[model samples]
Target: MAPMGIRLSPLGLAVFCLLGLGVLYHLYSGFLAGRLALFVLGDQAERAGPGGPDAAPGSLPEGTVDLRELLAVSVLAAVKGGEEVKRVRESNALNEKAKGKTREGAEEKMTSGDVLSNRKMFYLLKDAFPSVQINTEEHIDAPDKEAISWDRSIPEDIKKIIQPKKVPAESVTVWIDPLDATQEYTEDLRQYVTTMVCVAVNGEPVIGVIHKPFSAYTVWAMVNGGSNVKARSSYNEKTPRIIVSRSHAGKVEQVARQTFGNKTVIIPAGGAGYKVLALLEVSDKKQEKADVYIHVTYIKKWDICAGNAVLKALGGHMTTLTGEEISYTGSDGNDGGLLASINVNHKALVDKLPDLEKASHK
Candidate 1:
């Protein structure tokens, strides 16, 4: 150390100073490069520096509970947007003479709540969490659309079981249904209207939220974060109550009737989301709860993702009629049909699918 301090000539000293500065700069840049952060405000989002990992496509940190809370707020805004439409529809501002006459007239009849909510939800998500991959039933055509990165905050237990080898090299993707049960919403079946948001990590539904604007009830769940409302099954009775679609019952009613017989009461409700919730909802008058939810028709992933998440979180089951689990990031259409119930043993209903097919063919 004494020799190093005393032995430098002019040229050597100059070279050493330059080298030291170079090393310091390299260290500083290395430390600060990836730590750049973003700050967002109402309609004003700003980036402090340009070196976030999100700058790289399909790379993001794991999501956390904060993301779930953000998702909940975003979904609630969608529900509020739908409420706005319902409010206007009930206000009598539009003349009753032109209800459901033409395509434009029909759109005007419902007040564009679905599209409006879809737009708001997609845009708000973009502004707040810029790195998430988003898929929606309604396509948004914003020019500056950018998919950002997300540092997923997965549950520890789930993360342990999910092999790192199985996770795809992509950011988390969220599927959104701004408004579920459009037909029921238009028909003023307010109870059936729901806004849904689902987050799929590695093609799995890890987080889901179902919001009902009319009832001001919201249910959400994560892999480890249980639902706000715990699901209680009313399945002890010999005869179980079942729910089917009011608009698209299809072979479900026929197969259900064949399997459960006349003693089983099949409650017809609108919206797959609403039907799922009915399993938990106690009837106002009769105080009865649904025991099973069956839908043996083609449905979309967005329609069932939130409900499925809620049901699974409540220790219930939601799967294809063929006893297959619904894949969130797979095909948009669920072709095999769906069967969901809380507290009821799934094996009984799952075993009946073959008999249902046989009976339907007859």
Candidate 2:
């Protein structure tokens, strides 16, 4: 035999070619499917990189940390603070002291509850996000070096709602009211007490977390990111019920009466956070439901920023008496008087209001 020669018929060659083509098509289809899956998942590549999801909390440089992570940290801090509030209240050791006088000449007080909660919340956030600016209601010189423990996990529902993005530390600000309604807390009005945290990006509140220590309830929202609480479907626009501060009710009641008529039901409550929750209709008690929240005279940003973010997330608006959006960057005080509403025409309500100053005089 000279040399064995291998030969294939035309049909055999065609079959071989078809088999090769099928293999290539399968490989190509698999590659394309993977790319499509990554695209739909949103920022999966970013999360896999440094300072991403795999990185430990506080391991990344300031501002490089993911916003979703920051939001989760803030939620943890708020709940931790709420726990402190409840602990101190149950101990019956408020040790309340007068902090100073409010702009309206009312005595502003601080207590052990405020200090402990503030320390807990501030350190928790600062440890997780070292460079982000944090503004807390209480001022304490001591550092909490007790090795705070918190679960860095974000809730699946929350993660589903918030998109992935990294915000620079310089552009982010965290406001913490460790113990809102301390006065009410001292008065045994535990329902009004709340621990709140707000994350403002570029001077606008984008994330809000409010926790009621007494009831162990928490409601949070991130702008464009979803809220745990649902907005009220119905609003009483005509003769609308309004929620005002029980502590600062005089001026707001007068203004609300002048604007919405004397028949307007003015529900007096404590704490800005509580009043805002009422606007969202997330009240434990039925009487706390209201159409709008009105405040006259000065208010602090920490007192209302969380509420503002919550309102904005729900497609509502919170602004000045003259319908101006409040800025959270520079001064902490809002002197324009506060007007917040959901489900109703906020502008229409603002337009009806008389001058706050003139109304106060009357």
Candidate 3:
């Protein structure tokens, strides 16, 4: 023997080592399989109802994602996208990064985060509803012609929500704003940043979702369908609370003074969607919610579509100060200065501010 300690031959040692490695590999594989099983089984509720193996008879259609599923997907995409943007902003090199511009001449303020998030949502939606037309704020592409992937884990219950009749892609459209308050986002006003998505069929909004990334709250609805999330707001205050733009406070106070009088409390906020949410948000034990959201300057359609949908679902109203319904799908800019309120005082408030449309021209 070479030595007393080296009793076993090299072949024996090699065999022992191989056996140990095999055992380790087997344990690792088992762990991975267990994890995969957990992930697949965790969302049981999502897979329940008419789509599961025990699905209700005749509950499904040819193929589609319903309005409720669309709203849920929108919130999911927005929150995930907002998280990416937040991470990018947290980096020390945010301002040093270059920004892209849209066709409208406004700084696009797109980061890798935005592109990635937009693509992620697009793919997710496209996979769920292969024949639907979808559009986004970052890029102007012919949505009807875009390609889609077959990979998706969407539940059958979601697909059954689509109408039994197939709608052509050209007739339906979905608008997405991966990050709504790009300016406020760059300025570190995290609360103002939101991810928005709207679905319009034949130039009308059927569903909308607005998600506040930093706050992690989502407001979404189908047109005139009761809001899935209820927000308790006490509208008992003597003086009305008004929400105005933080970036452009031009003539807002003057308008408020003329419209609601000197007693009204004005709250400055960024992002049109957030301003609308402020109307429903109650602070502390008391209620300090806004009674109205008034903006005289022109705003993009993506900024208010989700807000309008949610407000409408709550029996609230958002219309031009001149009291006209704002149409979606055909245009990007909304020239009609908006007046939104959750209370029944919409007509009363509109009557109070009769000159807003004329004032906007000035």
- Where in model 1 is the C-alpha error above 4 Å? 1-70, 91-111, 143-171, 281-288, 355-362
Q: Candidate 3, 208: how far from true, in Å?
A: 2.2
Residue-wise C-alpha lDDT for candidate 3, range 249-323, written one tens digit per residue: 555677667765688778888788778777775232222357778887677887887788777767778888788
lDDT of each: 0.63, 0.84, 0.67
Model 3 scores worst on lDDT over the 10 consecutive residues at 158-167
1-362 in candidate 2: lDDT tens per residue?
A: 79989899999999999999999999999999999998866676566665665555555654465677777888888899898889988999999899899877889999889998999898888877778899888885765443675567777877788866677788888999999998899998998899999999999999999998888788989898788898988998888888888976776777677766889888889899998888775756633788988888788999999999999999999998888999989988888888899988888888888676454333
The TM-score leader among the candidates is 2
Clashing residue pairs for model 2: none
- Candidate 1 local lDDT, residue 104: 17
Reference-based TM-score, model 1: 0.66
Q: State model 2's lDDT.
A: 0.84
Compute the lDDT of residue 230 as modeled in candidate 3: 52
Q: Which ten residues in a row have the lowest lDDT in candidate 1?
A: 48-57
